[model samples]
Target: MRNVSINQLDDTPRKVVALGTDYSHGHLLPFHTHRRAQLLYGATGVMQVRTSDGNWVVPPQRAVWIPPGVAHEVLMLGVSTRSLYIEPGAVDLGQRCQVISVSPLMRHLLMEAVAAPLMYDRVGRDGALFDLLLHELTRSEVLPLHIPMPAEGKLLSLCQTFLNKPNAHQSPQYWAEQIHISLRTFNRLFRQQTGLSFRQWRQQACVVLALARLAEGEAVTRIALDFGYESPAAFSTMFRRVLGQAPSVWLEAAK
Candidate 1:
């Protein structure tokens, strides 16, 4: 689905432009760039965004702040999204994409902003609402919901393979053997290429893949088993450790 409607979006002369749109399950947006920074949040379901820098997953109650001029594509996992387009320099949300948590109040504000006129008054109640929205965005807490891929072709290929079938049971030694490298050399290369140790990267890959599977209506038990977790509790512990909530609870919030 063409949810963002960039053709209809006119960011000029407006500090903040909001749009509320829905996407069907598995909808994909081709790589594109926006002149304005985008705060793309899902009211329900999950969003997977891939940029040159890394891949980010935005779950429910969270949003990804994509800087202006960055080429990115989003895969909507059955989500209804609320998007805010801010003119370049209107907000200093850094120079890269980062996932940020959304407060209950901020969620309400976004809904209200999208319902307001395209060109909201800058001196009236609408102006104050948008102002508050911007403030909340600036203070939003960043979340660890990204997986960085290595630039090296060999390492990138290996990383992509692991991401496709992430399993918690795999050890660094196993991965090193898969790449036909000594354990010591594998450790050095992984750090140099991905900026993360093999263990760290595996866990991150598992978490990222877990988010996608959960969004597709898979049960936590099945997902845990698929990811090589010994038990549902073990999987929930890892999920909670990374996301600060159990998988079931997180899925409930997304709904």
Candidate 2:
């Protein structure tokens, strides 16, 4: 198996490895792609991957499927992550990348795959293992954590800046002016490109930040205040609206 630098990874066949490890680095890898599909899951820690498609956060309950040869990067707490890589042609797994929730059966299968003996020479076992992994993957749920990318170029840049900061709420008109476009044009273009209004986009970003904070076990009051809510109650209301549950409930489920 050839281990190339992350920059050298592309959508081509080389050495495909089912690599597993726990890492807590904030940004796991730079924007990159490889010829093999990657199944990134962390059963014990917080993990999130950002691709051009959107953000895929791997909670203990889920796994992220990265299609073969797609240029994507990951970011999260670098602690313990169980990442697996499979070649499109090598394994009977799909080339389409996505995020899937982890079932107890799937988690147990993953553990077995990683624990296989290095000298295990049973092709039957290997094939069975890969097939089981693929089966588990087929049952994965595409999480909403993957917010689609905005196509309005200038507006997209503006949105990205806000997303990166994630601490301040930018008005749509302000973003429009910053992008040298009128407020009306900005709204029109955003809806045309992303199927979401400016407000929806911002809310998604805010929710992503909130999820990160929640994963860290941050206090609800402080997290809400940091995100510019006047009070925790308001923030909780908004959270329930977007997430279909209160922050505490969601966190409890995650825990």
* Most lDDT-accurate candidate: 1
Q: Going through the candidates in order, what is the number of backbone clashes in each? A: 0, 11
User: lDDT score of model 1?
Assistant: 0.85
Question: Estimated TM-score per prediction?
Answer: 0.92, 0.79
lDDT of 2 by residue, 1-255 (tens): 122343333332333334456565574677887656677777666776776655655655567778777888777674455556665655544544556667788777777766654333446685577567776676676655655567547766766777677653568878788878889998998888767787887777677677777877788899888888889898888878777888888777655
Which residue segments of model 1 deviate by more than 4 Å?
1-4
Model 2 quality (TM-score): 0.79
Please give the RMSD to the true structure for each candidate, in Å.
2.2, 4.3
Give per-residue CA lDDT, model 1, range 49-126, as digits (tens): 998877888877789999999999999987888998888888888998999989889999998888888666899999
Best by TM-score: 1
User: Clashing pairs in model 1?
Assistant: none
How accurate locally, in lDDT, is each candidate? Answer: 0.85, 0.67
Q: After superposition, how far is residue 193 of candidate 2 from its true place, in Å?
A: 3.2
